[model samples]
Target: MAAENARQVEARVPPQDTEAEEAVLGAMLINPNAIPVVTDVLSRDDFWRESHAIVFDAVRGLYADNNEVDVVTVSAELERQGKLERVGGRDFVHALAEAVPAATAAGHYAEIVREHSALRALIQVGNEIAEMGYKRPDDVAQLLDRAEQRLFAVAQQRRVSDFLPIRQIVHESFDRIQSSQEGKAHEGVQTGFKDIDDLILGLFPSNLIVLAARPSMGKTSLALNIAHNVGVDQKVPTAIFSLEMSGLELGDRFLSGAARVSTHKFRNPRLLRQDEMDKLVRASAQLTEAPIFVDDSAGLTMFELRSKARRLHDKHGLGLLIIDYLQLMVGDTRAENRQQEVAGISRSLKQLARELKVPVLAVSQLNRGPEKQTGGGPRKPQLSDLRECLAGDTLVTVSSTGERVPIRDLAGETDIPVWTLHPDLRIGSRLMTNVWRTGTRPVMRLRLASGRTITATANHPFLTVAGWARVEALRERDHIAVARRTPSPAEPLDFADDEVVLPARVAEKVPDERFRHLAESDVLWDRIVAIEHAGETDVYDARVPGTHSFLADDVVSHNSGAIEQDADLVLFIHRDPTDETKKGVVDIVVAKHRNGPVGTRPLAFVEEYTQFRTMARSDDREPF
Candidate 1:
């Protein structure tokens, strides 16, 4: 009974087989041929005992150096490294060779050692995970990701896929082709555009497709149209990670496209006609049954995206995954530079597509290179432009529940409560998901009808009468929304007196009571009096995901790229500069197609519906 109990106790220890470790080392010592076979599968760390590990390391070192690896050579190597006595000397080394029955079982013994090593690694990871639980890490998603990575590392140690025979791979390929011919296997999910579908075949599984364009080029609109086709039309479960736009805004776009109504009507319901309203109701009812899932969570990290996607896939089965612009998603924070971080993100996205066995459509933004091109009717975007793709120095101020706070100090802060506008132009409180400085840029100052002037980047979008429009798009008479009442924070204004001509600087010139009077209030429309250049200054933007817009200097502002190498298909959207209304022909340039032809396909942008439709001809005419 005591012997049986002792055996059980031994079994309970971290999974390790001392006898297998000895056999592997012994087989290597006996047969010179076994050295190559053993070394391929087993590392020094595979041995459970310290002495056995030391001996194995010595043998491996000798073999690596192209020196003879036998009992004598291994023992001499260990001794040279001052580890002979520590690993039980020559006597133990000789015993290892004598104990093995035959060298033929070296591969089997090595496999046993590898299995135990993996188990031991698993135990170590379990312990680390338990400690992590006790510590109660702040970011639970990151902690879970770390735990999953640790377990996968152990599994990967034992997993190896040798090269398959060409004959077998050819048979598999033929089978797939036959199944596709018989309509039993699909080439890929249809992208809803006949020209796009024909050019690249379809959005194939395990492929990363990048859709890139400059700002206001309708990148989001085109992506949404394709997503709608796949999800609502075809009944394929689609996951859209809208890091920039909110879920409600996406819904509005979807409704507008489906009903063939103008998106402007959705934002300003007063403009909605009875016929359009009927179309929207019917469209909403039809789309209510669609298998589309949207996660409008702002500033999502790569790990969080993977975890959520895996869970979503496991539960409802995902056929397609779309990320609205890849550059917005972050990778490992420890990356040395922005370039490394983006490259890591790109690689991770490709891996994600392969792992999930689904098509990943990632929207990308082009750098300012296209805009700076001279002598151009319309500068066509290139795949290389994806490597590039910020807002102004205004002291940002946000108010919540009648309390005023400086937006500058809130950078990097999360879950801060603030009021934001919804798609229907209604003001509601939502947590500011993320806040960060875009960059220092030449700002444009807009003087409001109330004599309140605010400065921001030319590309920064504000809540205008005709929905969100950038500073460059805003005209002198265009009415922008602002808070109707000043925030009644208990603290008085403390801005230092300066000649910087900033909004903050203007605040210092007024009395404490007057500053409070000019503080951010309820939502009201304010007309633009004058718009002019305000030199250059540091500008900040906040991400309020569900609303996509945030209060900046008492006016709503829209919160504002990457590796193309891993992409199997690279597409660029080219809208003519002269088509300022964007209600015209846009070219979908297939810049890089790994398995097919590359050319431009013209698509018409239905401005009212915010949808992309196939062109009638190459002359840039709409089919409709």
Candidate 2:
């Protein structure tokens, strides 16, 4: 047993390279040039040996103060910090200086140290993940998200940049200016439209550009136009995160716009003429060659989106990112209010743009207040209008395993099958596709005779004795249907012991306060005892696709904004209703430009083709 314990201790040794750590420290101590290179990659914690870490910390301290970094200076800095005796005194520092053969290989040695440090971090993360698996958190999605984030954090350690001297920054700036003068460095990815490009300087990197407008104002059309121009015309790799539309739908629109054919005719191929069909075929072939990747998954949390974006950026060298309609995104569940959630999301998007060194174009929706103004020709959406835009604790049974889980815990789970009722009042089973966070709305809690209650929006529907009725339409004493038998999932849940969800029989055994056999039903009819307004809350609706309804609280149920400051640029799409002469002309309002002039750029909206283009005068035809 003692020998086995010894082997276990030996096996548990962390990854480290003491030789590389000493070599890097020795190089930095001897040569001044090696200090900058070493500092770029290695930090104090990156060193395996305690003595080497103390020496490196001293060297960094000297460098930070703009002092020459050498064996003498590092020793003095260590002595000043009262760490010299702890780090083997001045003799060890002199020995490190003498140990290095050359300073030119310091960067290579530093890389070795950084790599070992990264490996150590990864090992730590693995241990944390193992502990998490042992604990078995209730929300598996959040657990997975946190684990992914820990892994990403370790990977990002290598990319950490140290503070650069002003001299180095000035030299880089001068070089960039010279390159620009020589016509070698373009400002940013150019949108095909000259007018908009002139205003915003062509979507600069490390910037968050928000394109917002009311529904059907061609915001998505314009965004896709820019994406097409960058990915197809400029040959830059682009990623599109579409929360509102499916990838297939976006593909069809892209084909229609690029082919210059009417979307209506394109969707119905039979209506297309021979030339239009040829154009579409040619456009489809061209689109296949473009470097535009699309992820149309619904309700992506910020962490999931960032993880995907980082993967794409690493794999394909992403140039631009576009998100359609920000309002559909789910922020951190811990946020106390919708405004705070939006603010967090806004800051995260900006951080992502900066981290990837790419431009982020996010689509946003405006509140209805813009449209309801009394004296409006066309109510232009302002930055403030962007702010006002748009969980049930009910235990739901997993149709597959008959495990009763809270609906709120399943916010982002897209593939869990649940028992549901079709709009035709037929009982069936379907995947609880998505839990969309329809932001804060007035809710009503209805109590049933069986003591089961559900809080939902007024429009949320439930199956009744008479056809399906919404919470608002149903009166008191109305009988609602509940499933009596347990749903047999394909496989038994492995996480039955996590206390996340209890099986029907387990609920009866445990008899916890939260545990009730409300899920056990066989077409049981229960009358609504009371209906009361439960105040406003961030409610969620599950999308059970074909059935269009999910069993909530054992009853069949029907399914169903911030960031002005964090954004580098804000664009509002406005269509003038009073102007009849310029039929489809819409104004791209640059509401806020952090570093440039704010103005409106006129672009023509081709409604039939679902495209945006440069406006043409009566005498001139300018290709957008």
Candidate 3:
């Protein structure tokens, strides 16, 4: 009876399987092949006993170092780590090896150990949750969020996604293709924009779509429009978690979009006329009947958002989830820095999308680096500009010339202006070409055959009288000379005949007029020449007077004003250089669409309202 009572007491303890842990360790020590099998399922923390955890860690160290694993090796490693005595010496290690019958069942033994570890984790999580509930936090929502997150962590610990056979994958792919062919291809929710839909083929389930832009670039408006289209127009359930904006503000924007009433009118209803008031009322009525839900919770954590999203999805069958800007969402509390926090948040959002089998549209902020542009029209956002986000190989467009190029080629070349293209276009058209000089300075001093040195600039000459004289000398190619600028204005610049000028006979051999003129004039020209000599040609070659002569075509063009030959997207925004008007007008550019042809679809943006719409033909007259 006493022994039976003792058994009941022992059963009340937390879940653990010491024998299974020992068996796994024993298999790993005996058979080298068994290490991988057990490692796949178990981590060091999976061992119930502290000594076993230490021994397993030692074994792992040996395996990682590509060393043999045996009783002697594990003991030596533990000793190196100063943990041999802490793990009950070499006798305990030998005992563990004796516990396993063979290494072939290591996988089975690992499974048992993992099962017990998961159960213990679940019990710990349950206790913590219960304690939190009893404590009664001020924000009941936050409490629930923490509890659900802890439970999810427990679930994830036991979840193992193993490799599947190609046959199974092939069958699934065939079914998907068959469905697409049968006109059931719209498996993902549409964003209601025809051009965007054609490019992305709609937002697929378990996908995380990040829409990033600079401040006042209309990313929030675009996100709202998509959510409205899916929830109100298509009647699909949608949820928007706005950390930056309030529910009332979001509702006001929605009413303006649906009713075609200006946001100013919605915000200041007292200023609205009778006709506008009627439109507002009707729009509000329609919106009230829609299945779209909004949560304007401030400083919301990822855990809280995920819990709320799951609840909404389970209860009302959510079709789309939108987060109003990713940066504002609170990250892991234990994260060491902002970057780490952001990475954790991003991974969590992706996992949530997969878990719920729904598309997550996350709004993100672009870095200020793109916004600091002084020359280009209005700076366009790129995938690289995403705050703390890493995007693999992206297709970018040159904003100046609307040329498409890959992002990989642009690395370490940030000062070179580039924009991201919409992923819907295949071919791009050539626009107006602009000449860009690629040297230390725009203007260079040169000496003419008359022994007269003057400063000359590329393209249009400098307006200074002396500069014009040099320009004339360059055009006339008379008494050509080249010189380096002097540090002191009072000192005369030194001219080097051989260093700067080529022989007239050699210069005359070139077909390019600009090159011929430059060479004849003895101007050290080592930059791309874009001019109309016989016809327009992008001259990438330049002759180095002192160096061995080769075909000029060998030199690549690095012109800032001209577009890259391999540009993928053209990101354009309308902002007057004078800054007279508000800046927000943007076009979604798809220079190399993965699914369709390259095209630019204009969207009307009102800076005051922070709203975007399909640009009307009448509005096309406005500068962009």
Candidate 4:
């Protein structure tokens, strides 16, 4: 008995040693979840999974034909394109797999990876099922056979007394809190004209949320609005982590957006009146007094957020955590790959949300995938724009583009707000509907304007649908990314997929400042070659576009909008300078127009223009 016990004990790991303890604690400092990944990757068997093969394939597809695999660089590469899915998307590939092939080890390594991965996942599941408490498979197997014989059909088979127990826990939670009718009489909380889903999904103590978006749209604006509503309006203890911007910077943007002042103009303190200053002072004072906290670490780590968040809640009884964006977070593993690093960060955030029982709002970035879709038509954003994340209990994709037709002789063009993301203009982090529609319905007509005006009579005359939906969206965003796939696959693996090779000069250009800052002639000329070389996309002409003032090194493929002075520079977009030889396309001319602070000329593009700038690089590896 002693010998057997000694052998068994020796097989297992001893208690955490001093060195191991330091490493584990350090790794989890940013995100507690990094512990699992660090521990799991200790063995090849744990690192390799059948599910990972598909991730590798998607990763390989990102590079060009002239490129060779650099084992040290692939993970960071995928993270930039937002190509790595958070859940089972591209992020998953970077997460579980670390096998790097030698330059001489030939064939489609991606395909080989996928095949092996599928097999591994199957085996892994089987192993788990086999380990479950069997209490003798003979008795259970005989019992199952007898039940099948008596029931005799798949349609009518299930265990009895499923819900008979565990009824007590439900009633216990339900026992607390006031009833709806009684609760309504007390002054707090308003339904944004929409009937409350009313399952009572409150922000319990210590919850985190991920709220994501593209650029210049309104992520912080929306976040602050919620903080105001919760901390000041509802008296909930809330905290916000602003990684890229400072607390002061956040305060300025919030005031400018909320008060309808131009962000640039508001900086000049001399321009304010006594009353105006009072309003600003009052808003700031009210916010400071509220139980709202802010963390503005420019290079924030997941460990810092968790540590700060935990301390804030524990000490102050914090209720909610708001991360401005997920990418800004650094996790424990200094994984060689950025995409994998982000996956570790994301995994930590989800766990934090669950563990704390409070909703977390993490803002995310949309990939440039929509701009890649083809044809000379406006690209509507789908949930596909959100990188790393797929679908959650709630999801919201907000895309808005408006047009003005010169108000035909000075009525100053009706700047009709049109959400181009969807014809319906609302694809949600779904709560209880297949589609979230705007426009006209007898029951609901969504009319959100430039100044945050949602045209629905709130059950409480206070908030708008825009305000209401913002909260709803955060509450429903999935803790994990969702990938859209059906049983019948559309993209069959072509044994003859294109062999990608990157240009020797080009791959080196990624980290080169000189290559990025090339003179106009050289930059423009090289870009033309890359555009022509780029595999065909549906959105734009393959020919290179002429140079522009902003981000000249980077490719400019998005639908540009410039109305009067909205752009001080004229972008003479040219297609096929060699083939068509046209001097200019439609003269992307900018004139003057104003809609409050955003008053500038409108130059909305009918189609997006793709650029390959030598200057810009993905924020994966540092410039060597």
Tell me, by lDDT, which candidate is best.
2
Give lDDT tens digits, candidate 4, residues 283-332.
56665677878888888877667666665766676556778776777766
lDDT score of residue 491 within candidate 2: 32
Candidate 1: tens digits of C-alpha lDDT, residues 1-624? 999985885578787888888888899887878888988897777788999988887776677567898888898888899999998889999999988877799999899989988888888788799899999988776788878766655755733245655655887789888987887635889887878777888898889999988889899999999888898878999999999999999988898888888787666899988988888888888789999999998998899898788778877889999999788988854543344466678888998898778989999877654574435555676654543102333434444554546666777899887766655444566788766654445567888766778877665567654456667778987878765533344122232223112223334676565433333324566778899977656656565544555566666666542256679999999878665665488889998898789999988787777888876535432211
Model 3 scores worst on lDDT over the 10 consecutive residues at 548-557
* TM value for model 4: 0.36
Residue 249's C-alpha lDDT in candidate 1? Answer: 91
Q: TM per model?
A: 0.51, 0.63, 0.47, 0.36
Sorted on lDDT, highest at the top, how do the candidates line up? 2, 1, 3, 4
* Residue 356 in model 1: lDDT: 74
CA shift of 216, model 1, Å:
0.7
Collision pairs in model 1? 392-538, 392-539, 393-538, 483-521, 483-522, 484-521, 484-522, 485-521, 485-522
Best by TM-score: 2
Residue by residue across 569-607, what tens digits does model 2's lDDT show?
Answer: 999988867668757889899988986899988898878
- Point out the worst 10-residue segment of candidate 1 by lDDT: 492-501
lDDT of 1 at 278: 88
Better of 3 and 4 by lDDT: 3
Give me candidate 2's TM-score against the actual structure: 0.63
| Tens-digit lDDT track of model 3 for 234-307 | 88999999989999989888877776677876556688888877877887887898899999999999877888
lDDT of each: 0.74, 0.75, 0.59, 0.35
